[model samples]
Target chain A: MIERALKTGGVPIASMLKRGEVKILVVEDDKFLREILVGKLEKEGYTVFEASNWNVAQKHIQGDRPHVILLDIVLPGIDGFEVLSTLKRNRETSAIPIIIISNLGSREDVDRALRLGAKSFMIKAHHTPQEIVDAVKKTLEEYYLRR
Target chain B: MKLRVHGTLFAKFFWTLTALGTIPMAISTLFLYATYESRIRHIVDEDVARELQLNSGIQFLLIFLFVLIMATFAAYIISRNISRPLFVLTEVMKRIAGGNLNIQIRVRRQDEIGDLGNFVNEMVRRVKEARERQEEISAVKSEFISVAAHQLRTPLSIEKWAYNLLLDGDVGKVTPKQRELLEKAVMANESMIRLVHNLLDAARIEEGKFGYTFQKMDFVPFLKKLLQDRTVLLREKKINLVVQHPLPRDLFLTADEERLSIAIGNIVDNAIRYTASGGLVEISVDTAPPWVTVAVRDTGIGITKEDKDRLFTKFYRGSNVMHIATEGTGLGLFLAKNIVIAHGGEIWFRSRETEGTTFFIKLPLEFSPKSPSVVSHDSFVGSI
Candidate 1:
């Protein structure tokens, strides 16, 4: 799934993928935005899961153990920073490539997220849905290459 | 308030006068009286005694005058010593009140006046600290604005993506009229994204966070891709975008490609935005030893004489263009100049009102082999 996308300019929609494998968990708070993102990712032929808050995100993270995590910084409880630090600390989930989709665009925040082991940081309003999908695919490709 | 003396100058003056005048007069008069007392009785004659008394009286008069002169001199010296430091303290207060915080009183005494001097110094320091705290708070506020601009982009990004989907027919195919309306919305969304991005960038540049990543890259592909990206704008405006220089197959330049793209893109975009329909914008380059100069000349409604001086100033929209284009935030040229200078380059422009404008960006042929940092270390020409 990842290799095909990487070969074709990293367009997630163009690359065919297996349904059960290559799971992506999206953790976002805004219901409309979460649905839009979920719709975009599902259209790209990937198995997707949604978590509206950090607690739900944690349950999905520990139980499903998704391949890639599309995380948002601002959440209802225990924001993205805390969630990021927690996942990165765990032995099982540490290898999962997490990309931060956040409204926190300050240099300090970006540097902090990157330093905490996020694969990439995306400003929510700055990127289109398709671009975000591409970012997910590119990050997945890079993660596999590193492994 | 009435003058209250901590240490009395009057007392010093009185003591000086008593010591120099009264004491000396009493001693001299007693000695003179003692020497004449025995001789006056022995003489016994009335005339001789009276003559001797007169002589003693004249001597006393001379001694009194001498004592008075010495006393006045001593009083003057004592009074000056007491008042000189007070005069110095008054001058120091005047300076501190006039916003000079650097001066400190010379606390040479351990008396009440010395304590007063130290008190003044402490007050000045507190004032200075308060001013510094005010400055720090303002800095934090500006930093907050920058961070807020970043946060503002998220919603804008969502809107942008949503609109783009509709325009691309991701949801469903639409009629020609609906497509045109959706396209307008897409353009508006794009403008918002650009604005938010520019605001964040300008704030970062102001706070010295916008840095450079130097890499060895071919300039030919970079410029080609940069211009090709803006083909839509050229098509929409029907402007003839010309590349004057035939780019070599391999034109290598040591620079930061991302920042250079923004800088050059801003210039070309501005050219397209301001120029009327069917105008010309030409991009050319000149290569010489140690310098590679890129020039962008636009046949736009050129800058006015008044606006030319402040063209690159942040948030300074030209009066002429304000009616023509209300979309600009006036940060593009300012940011472009900073990025170019950050790469050890210079940006200069020449324009005539209603004629045209030509902006030239000159970068060094070589860069420092190490990481090239930002250009906000010193105040630049574009800074307001």
Candidate 2:
């Protein structure tokens, strides 16, 4: 149902390119958190796609690639680390800035996610939705400036 | 009266050698006398026999002396050989009993003493394994707490965002009365979030996973800013919070600012929590070369004698304050002590029941990160 919604609701690639609207993909397992994040990102005037797990996230990336990806560390089957490494290794998705929003606040977890090529790491409980939005904006600005 | 021999191995060996020598000497002397009297007396002249008897008597005396000397020498060597290793073993055992698990008994011999040394080594190895297993179990326990706390935090984060959106009028328009209630809910939710964070930190400290990123920072303004953040709490309790001036602005220290803030903030929070309305809580800093001490004094219900001993222990609450405030997790002082000690610092308190309590945190100006094993071990001792 989520994949079908993504297929139908997502703007066409040509229109998105023509409009130059920034697209954000949120990969989170929790439904309410995903909704709030998606809601916040949509409210911020960005086209947001929600993924409950890595498979759905992979479909979103392949179908209509997002400009930025908000990744969660813990997920069913393949974790965020796997998804991050795979994306970083791939030439196509390597440039897509991925910011990790996780419940795991350990130094090891943060360092690991960053080392695996996450643009930034945010602890879920420590940051509000607004702060996360700020981080996304900052990460995107840095990404564009570096380019 | 009975002669009570102290039954030492040395003494036993000496007596046994003496007995062995004396018994043979006594039998030889009796046999020589019998033979000289029965056979030699009938065949030899009186003078010659008498001279022979005297010569034999001297020979026996010389033999007895030689045997006694040999026995004493042999017994001394044997006893020394046995007692020396035993002495070394006793000392090593004492050190092992004193919680030094890394020492090993070196054994070169293939005898009973060597067997004993090997046994001690095996025992120590097993003890070290058991201690490691215990540590692993503790790490697992900390991991459990960490994972559980993270799980709790996810929903709490969702709740926090939901509340934030509601308060920010993102969902809909909120009334003034509704905003006030929502703010209270936010505070309560934040406290719950803080509690989860504390549990995570405590677990990390236990598992020696608490990361420290130390940098040179000014101590005075850092403290002033921290106190400024707590002014609201001080105002709410109507407690007079004071920071003694003339605190050197150049009092620099190498510290993890985020962690040190939490440690100091916990101390200040505890002072605010326990202090009654219209009470005084004073914070002061004193620098003496390499050492900088921060003293937080509160004029509130002081620690009882029973609670003083375990004040820095994990999950410990004072007898007097438990009824007064039930919101404490009893982890603040425990965490404060661990963080302070991790920075090569010390934390101690002086309190008198029903009067007040003053906590002193003494930190080094230069933080030389001790090995994690040593830091965790020290914090473990502090927690216990």
Candidate 3:
């Protein structure tokens, strides 16, 4: 049934199978944006996990490591920078490609995100859901190619 | 205020000099007279002694008058020297208090007065440093505004995406009526987004954090692409956009493409917005050696007399266009001006109240390497 949905979505079957094996963890506090991102990613045939905060994100990371992480800068308990550094410092989670999806579009913020080991930075408002999904796919492709 | 201090200093010096000169001279004169009277009384007869004594008294009177005059003159000279620099220093301090931080006291003397001059210079330096520090703190405050604007854009983006998704039939097929309302909502959301972006850009420009990347580009294609992007707006308004290049060759210039586009785009957008439907916006490029000029002429409601002086000021909207286009943030032209100037170019306009407005942007064909992509905040402050 999932394959049929993927096929109807117009993605090639082989690529869909490969994408289905890839897990993406979304770390966003805003419920609506997170839902949209998750829906878009799932429709693109990727296994999606949602985390509203760093702790939840940590749990998802330990249980079943995601192939890619979509991180947001603002959070309730711990901020995105700390989460990014923690992920980068740890040997296991460091390899996973992290794409920052946030509304903080200042040059300084973008520079800081890139400097902290994010694979890509997308201004949440500046990009549509499809564009963001494309970014994820691009980051995943680059990650796999490098491996 | 000036006279009292001057008088006090003069009086103090005068009395001190007078006392020092007069008291010693008077006492010595009394001793010399006593000795001379005794000697003359012993040496000569009464008539001779009397004549000599009168002569000596006259001589003493003359010397005393000369000493008094000399003291007064020396005191006047010394006091004037001391008070003149003090006067200059006081004036400079008042100017500094009035918010002029560029003044520096020139010290010529090696005396205490010169030391005071040096101190005043040091004080001005410290004040300038403090002002810069305060400006930096305010820059941080503007950064806060930038962040707040970004936060505001987040939800707006969500609305934009959700509405777009519905319109595109991603979630379900949208009916024509539903699509029309959604389109209106999307346009409103997009305008809100534009306002937020403009606010963020204004904040960045103020803080001198608006980054630019310069590259050599062909001006014609760049301009053509920009006009192509405005097709929808042009079609909607039924405005005629005519591009004219008097020169047959392509105009080449070094610029930060994105920034220059915004600057030029602002003029074009303003022309379209202010002009009536079926009006003409003519964009023409003319080149003289080492200089390229782009003139945007519009058949629109021109600038009013009152708004003429403040056309490039932030948050300035023309009184005539306020009712016509209420959504203007008044930052477009201001940002456009700054961007153009940062490129080492000039922007100006000619307008009459009822006829039309024509904006001219003059740029150098060769971008000087001395002024890099990022313009200094001091330069911006001076421009305003």
TM-score of each: 0.66, 0.74, 0.69
lDDT of 1: 0.80
* Model 1 regions lying over 4 Å from their true place: A1-22, A76-82, A106-116, A137-147, B1-134, B137-141, B168-173, B215-217, B248-254, B367-384
Reference-based lDDT, residue B376, model 2 = 18
Q: Order of all candidates by lDDT, from best down to worst? A: 2, 3, 1
Model 3 residue-pair collision total: 0
Q: Which candidate would rank higher by DockQ, 1 or 2?
A: 2
Clash-forming residue pairs, model 1: A125-B154, A125-B157
Kindly give the number of clashing pairs for every candidate: 2, 0, 0
Chain B, candidate 3: TM?
Answer: 0.67
Poorest lDDT segment (10 consecutive residues) of candidate 2 chain B: B375-384
TM-score of chain A of 1: 0.85
Task: Choose the strongest candidate by TM-score.
Answer: 2
Cα lDDT tens digits for candidate 3, A32-115 = 989988998898888999999888988999997888899998788777788888889899989888999887777678878889
Relative to the true structure, candidate 1 has a C-alpha RMSD (angstroms) of 12.8
Best by lDDT: 2
Candidate 3 residue pairs that clash: none
